[model samples]
Target: MTAEILQKVASEGLPPTRMNARRLFGSFSFSHQPPYSRLPNELLSEIFLYATCRGVDDRHEIISTPIAVSQVSTRWRNVAISTGALWGTIIITFPISRGQISRALTWLKRSRSYPLSIFLDFRDPSWDWDLPESAHPFRWQDMEALIRLLIVHAHRWKQFELLTDTWAPIFTILHYSRRIKCAPILESISLSRCNAFFAARNATFAPAEMKVPIALFGGLLLDCLREVSLTGVHVDWTTSPLRNLTTLEFKYLATDVTPTKDQFADILEACPNLHSLTIIGRGPQADSPPSSSGSTATNRPDSRSKKSARHVELMSLTSFTFGFNDMDYALEILSMFSFPSIKTLALENLSNVDPPALQSLDATPLLKRLSFLDVSSDATTTPFPLSHIISLKLYSISASQATFSQFFDKLRNLEYLGLYNASKDVLEALKPSSNVDFNSSILPCATLKDLECRDMDPETLLKMVKLREAVSHLGHVSFEFSNLCPTLRTNFLDAGIDVVVQTTAQ
Candidate 1:
């Protein structure tokens, strides 16, 4: 009967039907099912999880699935949404439009039962200036609503981030009033250009009074924090309890109290598991003076207290990058770190008074790569000599042949050299025929494979050739220049160096 029914249905123009009356409502057998239908659900979940986690930049970017995932198929979407872990984050862009806020709220509601994470990125690309006053139709109300929603599930929240130019004072009062509940599971935070506390109090006329009860502003929350990036914010370590943090970076940290290394020691002591740290300004404000010798000590507002209670020791750090605006204090802080496992180090905006600070770093003997940026400081002027650097990248400065020779002579194992400047005299010294015998004292980059020289002049062709020969293992070399006059291009080709010219018109 089933076969006759199937034949009649097929004849009526419907697709051929399988005659399986015995199967009834039961799932089809393995041989009758499509390929991959028999695969275990666990394996499928793992595949989706890996893809979802790949491009995750932070908690915010991961609040939802990447849009491309939906294009796969209906089956994939079912699999993706079924994996509740994939939909656990709520990321929102600031100036939150009604639509965006509504979408984020819906996602948060769906994720409340599971662990939740919220990312608030106030950075808007459309604004010419970063000030909040410039934002059009700013979404403070939307943010307030979102914050209120998260407070209900604060214990289940995994991460919270607030990167904003400013916030309404009412929000601060709400936070202090014990109305702003934070999640116990929250793990990481990043704050940029915000005075979330007292600064908010004076922002407007009907400002909300500060009432948030704090055993600590950031104390209990520090237990699970894995990383923190702060710029222009004061970190109160004494009251804030911290234990297991791995990475901490601070830039332009403005504070009322003078910062000292001791305070830093205290802060580090609080977080015993810290692995990486980048502190941009080393000393107190310029208006403050040194009480001691001819020079003042490096000021760190948090590190000012002399008495050391307990110190946190970081045994897992593998990298450290320091940027200093003040030369004197930068020298002091660089000398303090004992990163036994450090492999990469970068120093930026170093002045003539600052190279002497390099002498303080004696910790990382296993360091593999080092970079110096925007250093116009002269060799004679620098109080310290950097002899340990093997791979070096220099920007915006040219050293005299003698100065460079002296510097490289100390790097016996130096291999990679990248020069960004192409002055005629500097290039001429690199030429083998030039009277400057760089061969004798200069370190031969035996393993050097890549060389890049930018902004060359028409007269520096011989120098390019010499540089190639200087590095015997040269495998790849590229030269980039702009404002290439015809004479310069001809000279570059004549010197046997491959040239790529970029003109303003293009």
Candidate 2:
């Protein structure tokens, strides 16, 4: 047979191969196969749903992989497009373009009845330019129109994430969404990088500009909000309706204006049944803004303040995470919230220490999972109390032998321990010279099961392996090295230690 005939005969069961075969038009001819035809329709539909729905993570990777898969043939395009599950997701990019928005909406419409998960990330500077000439989708004016379409099938919206550093469009969108009196199905809503709010009477960017009144939302959003994260946003009684929320993440940058204590009180008053909260604050931003002279500095709770915050007690909170540059703010939160049931505590950006608060935190017995990012242990001879922690993660420790030993000693029950930048002093103290032989008796971590050490020296790796052998509870130990530490990767493996090394770049 001829090569073409032979090639065609070998591919008889395959879908039309327009991807690599002859093309009749500029675009590949799509084979008219219903998305469900190639496989069980229901199963294929579920697969499409799995592929399209992503929580708060960026879908840039998922988007690229599927596009590549769909390019295999014309039949796949038909399957891809007809399977509304495949195209139901909404991924937002800033400088929202007219052409892009049009294409995205078209994709959503094809999902038949599947609720949409919209990820509108407005980080691009030129996003405003892409507004439709008459009814710009990127403009706040088009918010109602957008929400109207979404609410028509709101039950299908599994996730809604709107993340941006700008504030102008967020409130505008929220104001329009008030008509959604009952969307008992919205699963995730994230509004991050909030930099706008009318203060006692000054604009952040232009103090003289006339301010717009931001309408408060009470009890309207809680009917179905399961996971929510807010950053740099002010909250008051107006947003109290989100009482049903379970997972909440609050973050503010040091460059942000500190809300009056009453503003903070208003938020606490709303969510009574909150289960998990992650608070991230940049102290530098809080100090940058000028506070009104009349504002009270006394954090002592007044009756009115207590009334607002006390009404919505967080009795169900089980996980608490605090990332702060200032220790005072961290202390304030710990003193206020009596998280008797909290099991996880993650502390990040520990620049300074409030000795009193650290002492109070150590007394807690409920903490189980603890993680410290860039933790500073300069306060005293002992490390912070972590007797209750079962899993510990520490990153960016100073090269102090005292600090390293203190930290390791506290994690007696730890099953997972991750250490980054194994400092020079730590490695040297463990082994001053390569010629010195180490044994299992000198190791720490009596109950360690998984151990990961990043960016450490060969001497340190050897010590870690010996330490692992000494700890009977340790089942696996991993030594990860950056590309610059390839020699150490080889040295540890050659020394009979099982190590998994990953390059810093890849």
1-506, model 1: which lDDT tens digit per residue? 99999898778884324545435555454566566655566777677668667757655445445334544667666665566676677777765677876776666655537886666766555654434342534455655666666667667767666666544422431343254345456577666654322211012211122222233333455446677666544444445543567877765553343235565666676666777776654322322332222122223222222332222345566445565433334433443445544433444432222322322221111111122221222111211223444455543333455444444444454455555542344454444444435454433444455656665554564355656565433555566766676775676666555666555431
Superposed by TM-score, candidate 2 places the C-alpha of residue 79 at a distance from the truth, in angstroms, of 6.2
Cα RMSD to native, each candidate?
A: 10.1, 12.4
Compared with the true structure, all predictions reach lDDT values of 0.49, 0.50
Total clashing residue pairs per candidate? 19, 10
lDDT of 1: 0.49
Best of the candidates, lDDT: 2
Give the TM-score of each candidate. Answer: 0.62, 0.62
